[model samples]
Target: MLVSALCAMLGVAPVWVSCLLFAVAGYALLWLFSPLTTIMIATLTAIAVLSFVKPHAGAGSAVIAFVALTANNMQNNLTASNIVGMIIICLCPLSLGFGLNLLLARRQAAAALKQRLDREHTARHLHDTISNDLAYMILRIDQASHRDPPFDQNQYQRQLADLRAIAATALDHTHQAIRQLEHTDGPSTHIVQSDGETDKQVEQQRKRLDDIIQSQRQRLKSLGFQGDDILGTFDQPLTDDVLDLLEGMLNELYANIAKHADPNVWYAVTVSFDQRHVIVSASDALKDAGIQLGLGSGLERYRAIIESVSGTFAVTDDSGIWSAEITFPLCRRL
Candidate 1:
């Protein structure tokens, strides 16, 4: 359009001829200069030449036409428009995108808040019903054992049967609450699910851990790493939370190895469980010194996870080898 306008103003060859020439010259100039440079050079050259020629519409029309063309051609150029015009033209889509992102963030926050409230309600339910029942049973037992009376054996047996009935009812109610909580969407849902079918849950946990370990080992093998893994049998029960985190921890560890380990060297992953704690460790030779390594956010995140559960995380870099160890407790404290 600019080419046609220029040709019309100058009474040059045909419009098609001018456009073809401009396109060819533009395609060549772009090979040598950036788009902005080419635009500036072309505009200045045209204006300089037009200054020598007779003025067309007082020369301002040609200058305005050039400015319009330049502005339309460059999306991010400061010369696109006046402030208000720029805001209306360019910032509308950006503002819409930001508004959408804010809405999504708010929705996520609302969901998280709901989950937290649900957990609190479940905790309160347990304390209100289960705790009171247990306390009452304990008091009755104490009174039965230490009361100054002609102890009635039949009455005592009746009280014991009542206490047992109370305990059973409380246990049933506790299981129902746990089931409801397990259905809620959150990180801790799996932990709640752990309470049902102990043998099945334990088997699933073991399979998950073994799968993660074997996956990492296979990945290392594919990377030409000769690695060893000692997936020792657990001596004690691992808390549901600890078992859940192990999956993430192992993935992060293997990811770190994939990113930084020397493919030609040996890596090792060892799992050892004692009565009190479970130990997991991985070690690998570092890649060449020339390869840059980032500050391991993965390790830092897992460190926080371990420490939150009263577990410990340790890392050591020595003699071109990197190693990390995690020691987590077997029991989950109330």
Candidate 2:
């Protein structure tokens, strides 16, 4: 509206002056208003200038001056030539704004996707590292409860109590991880600590696997499963890396059994070690519902950890029984 008013005032001047004002007004409108509006104003200004100017100038000179004058007219004119010029000016801003908006939208979307990926990565890391270690701790505590020579009974009891507390804490952490996966917000920055203190954490964690099998044995017996003792030997003491991975695997297996296995069925867990590798296996009788075949997220993550350290995993569910087998190299010996 301001540009239009200015153009109106300029139109009252001589043809040359009016042409200059028209050009300025047209350019201003192109910058401020829609491209279409700028073109319309320029077109109108061109026609007005041509109509007001006399033709007494020579044809060639008239043509040249007309062209020059029209070029100077920034205001939209009613004439076709002026209209075209206004349209060209208006298109500049329209195209530029549209392209800029598109680029910005894409960048925002990419940033959002990256944030989601990072959050998921953090959740998986927490589950694989922290949750698994806690599970292993529970297993070891349970095993310690059933030792042959038997360390102090009170100490064993205390350990069992600690195991329960750890289990509860791990469950809470699992819930948090699930929430994080479902969230749309940015990634968490909090750091997680694993249970083992030294480089031997992994070996220590592996020994705890025997404890888990022992505890499961008791649970199975209570449910009327007359099973043999779990058999396994460790070639090396537990290290932090092995402990972290095994803990995750054990937790996944326990969860599956708790959620899907029949309470009345018998099950056995066994581990065997050689100079080169260690194998851990769990076998359980299936209920009428049968064992679900697909690997759960916990197990899948464990599998990934195992593979990352050059290990192998296999799961089998035949008839009504399920078995999981994991084999990994013994990198650090006891």
Candidate 3:
């Protein structure tokens, strides 16, 4: 825009190089900043530059020259023909600017479309992680029976603190993950979906899963569950989907405890790996004091998550003790 305006104004000025400088600066700003904002500002700036360029011809003169130039076919007036030529020469750069702006508008739309798609994809992955953890907390609360609510004022207070910490962690992770999603590989940078997630992306997700386990452990400990809780450490590499599924299952298990398990019962978590498959299991000493201790819908939901990746899910009530196990072959590469 600045270039076009300068070219329009300069016409044949002694300091014509100034127009080139303005054009360069305008293009630089447009490329470095948002195309939309730059185009708007640059368009106005171009008009301003044109106004100050001291052209012998303008909108008014161009109209007159157009009429005379049209008559030049029949009339023998050199001056009118020259005026028409000048008008065409003066309008060339402005026309170029108009076309350039239009091209930029198309590019802007493409970029926005790219961003929307990437945002949705990232949100699904990130939001699922946080939402799954949060759902577990909610389920725990819903499942707690008031028959003989455990803890006194201090216990209730501690439970409140633990809930707050868990929620805070989820909120923080949601914000950070989504923010990274939007900016880390901006809209202009296209990702080939067919290529799947890169090594770095897979590694980052694995780390996130580890953090989820750590935070969940802290939450369980705060709720009076500490002995032998599994510290999830895998000796083998796994695909992103498997890692996510594993983390989600553990989160669901915790939620089940929050919902069904007796507060006074002992809880333990176990995670193991064999030659071909990894096993993640949990058990609880039941208070069975007439409570149902059933899996209900939670079990089905967890089963679906595990089985989606061809994994197996099972829950057993051996005497007064309750145990659940999930196992799947690891996909080492993403």
| Model 3 agreement with the true structure over 37-141: per-residue lDDT tens digits | 665455444533443342332334434534644565446555656766656653654455455556767899988987875664455445445765687567546
- Residues 97-180, candidate 1: write the lDDT tens digits: 445556767999998988886775465456544554465456446645676644788966766676787588669868967886
Best-to-worst ranking by TM-score? 3, 1, 2
lDDT of each: 0.64, 0.60, 0.62
Pick the winner on TM-score between candidates 1 and 3. Answer: 3
User: Which residue pairs collide in model 3, if any?
Assistant: 140-258
Ranking by lDDT: 1, 3, 2
Per-residue lDDT over 1-32 for candidate 2, one digit per residue giving the tens place of the 0 to 100 score: 76666667764777788767767765875768
Query: Could you give me the TM-score of model 2 versus the true structure?
Result: 0.40
**Best candidate (score: TM-score):** 3
Query: For residue 28, what is the lDDT in candidate 3?
Result: 78
Superior by lDDT: candidate 1 or candidate 3: 1
Residue 115 lDDT in candidate 2: 83
